[model samples]
Target chain A: MLEVKNLKKSFGDRVILDGVNLTVNDDEILCIVGPSGAGKTTLLRCITGLETPDSGTFLMNGQPFDPQGTKDSDRVIGVVFQDFNLFPNLSVMDNITLAPMMVLKETKKDAEKQAAQLLSELGLSTKGDLYPWQLSGGQKQRVAIARALAMKPKILCYDEPTSALDPNLRQEVAKIILNLKKSGMTQLVVTHDLDFAQEIADNLLKVKPID
Target chain B: MSLNYVFEILPSLFQGAWLTLQIFFWTLVVSIPLGIVVSLGLTSKIRPLQWILEVYVWLMRGTPLLLQLIFVFYGLPIIGIVFQRYDAALVAFILNYAAYFAEIFRGGFQSVSVGQFEAARVLRLSYWQTIRKIIIPQVVKIVIPSIGNEVINLVKDSSLVYVIGLGDLLRAGNVATSRDVTLVPLLLVALIYLILVGICTLVLRRVEKRYSYFK
Candidate 1:
């Protein structure tokens, strides 16, 4: 289980998130929907330890998540960015295995074995040798998902996953999120696409920007 | 131009060219990595150190390298800091080129977005791992053109060793021109410099192509 309380963030007098509270069960897909400038990304950033929250507690199984220290927060939460910021220089396989091999100190053979399994799971079994720029938008998204999954996080976060996709592609991503939820992967997704949100979310929360 | 005159001087000019190549090659070997180290410092969070690097870069960039060559080779001896002719020239060139390369690397670091860092963190990659596996690879691709330009400039700048009485390529050209009382040696020197720059350009372009698959 993941929980956040009284989450607040401000940048140079403009408050982005204010007194926000959230919780996600072990078997639920929690989607946060809001309009542009509504701090949806900021909320994800805060939880992922990218943006420091002004006052909040991000707890995973009752333990506070630390952005700067230890291996727990990273192991607990992994995020797929809106742009799918895979390492451009690495092949898809390397991107997926980088964290596993480097941070986890797994051997090359072991990381590659795990990455091959995840790639096949994401339907990218043939794309291991290809670079991120070679992949289509949907393929990149799947690779980003695989990259995140390779870390074995308890909660996976997606930031505006469908915002860049066409209507058809948005549905495709929605299916992926729903499939992950069915597999019992806890997910926190922030998106403006209400249709996608409604179709996949077990519980929906609204994040509003501060005035 | 008589063939005999050209051939007679070829051996001496070749020797001088060899010295020039050594200077260019060694300076690149020493300065490129040193510049990268300095670049890391420049981008680090320490304010006082960053300030010092800023002033150093400013001074190096603002002054003519020729003046720097003179200062290190000649001016430093006023306080008992004497150096051999080659040492003084090499030291000055290394410091000057490292400053320029540091700025190039600094720009490369700046070009990488915050999103990359966030993604690395999300993936649980440590800070050094992010830099080694993710950030530096992209920075190398982005900064190739700038580095190429600086490297070619370094090839030409090696000619400045003549001012310190190091018998480099341009110095050979001068001695031959004075002895033979002709401009042919100067033409040969220019031709060799052009060839060196051409080779560097080709190599850099090839490296850039190798990394092009990223974007």
Candidate 2:
């Protein structure tokens, strides 16, 4: 349901993505793999409208994903940053429900219910009352994933979803992704972990790092 | 010291102290929200707006507050924008202190992690909603001490009202001490200041205690 046609991006004189094209079919786990400095993260950012491409276009469900000149573009896409961008000030529940309540115009009660369900499904039910600082890195990332899911987004982008975790925790995260695949969720995961991609991804796009 | 003199000076000075308290309370009530607004202006995405707000804050902060007071209380009347001396003093105090409070607020706001802001943006909270709900709550917790400092300073600074003959606590003490060179009455006024500042410190400590769970 997402398309990036001939996307090119650069910072100063250095090019990150040069004429890269990719498409993600609905209900598929699309793994974007490359070595370090492959612009995989930048590619994810462009798709999510967090960064503008220097050229080409990104379309989500046949509509342009342009946040630069638009009033509200963030509602259409959901992202889980590698660093786990949770609000330290808010409880896990608040962090998850915030987007649904504020942007989606869902009632607080409804948003809380959905958030609780998502957290429970992600094996984070008990941690909902706690802040990000109280959770392990794996738990925090799971909460971030729950937050992305709470929005009921058409496309879910995960930037190196399991990179920060220990080997044991990475398996737990992979299981969660595999479950999402079974449930038919559209996911675009950027990672260097080849084994995890092989285990969960239905389609793999390998980006080449330029010299 | 005659009990009658103590009674005479105490009653009048008490009234003047009440006036001081009134000015102090109202200055906070008006200036704090104004300070936050000015802070947002300085941090706005638009460069020209940010520049203008920075200049405004700089002009307000760089000059002596006494000069600002004189400019508002004395200079404004020269331009036919007449206000009562008390009104002029209050206006000057609010504007002058708002700039300082704004700077403190901006510092508190910036101290929040950039990641928190990105999270808020991704959640699609409007600029105003994110500021009010996420950013400001954290900022309030952080800026409590600085706000307390400014408020206590505000109590003493209320004495500056005497310059325009507004009859605040210091002015009354000055008049009382001039009449009686023994200085007991002035000492009483100083005691009153101590009590007020003491109460402020106690209140702020309670506030700091409530939010101390964070760090």
Best by DockQ: 1
Tens-place lDDT digits, model 1, residues A94-177: 998888888888999999999999888778899999998899999999999999998888999999998666667887888888
Q: Which stretches of candidate 2 lie over 4 Å from their true place?
A: A63-74, B1-7, B213-215
lDDT of 1: 0.88
- What is candidate 2's lDDT per residue for B1-215, written digit by digit as tens? 78888888898789889999999998999999999998888777889988987888899889988888888878888888988988988899999889998999999988987767766666667777788778887898999999999999999999988888798998888888998886878888999999999999999999888775443
Task: Fill in the DockQ of model 1.
Answer: 0.80
Residue pairs in candidate 2 whose N, alpha carbon or C atoms collide under 3 angstroms: none
Clashes of 1: 0
**DockQ scores for all predicted structures:** 0.80, 0.49
TM-score of chain B of each: 0.96, 0.94
Q: TM-score each candidate.
A: 0.95, 0.92
A24-143 per-residue lDDT for model 2 (tens digits): 999888999988899998898777766788998777778777644334443566788889978777889998988788777899999999998998898888988898888989998989
lDDT of each: 0.88, 0.85
Q: List the residue pairs that clash in candidate 1.
A: none
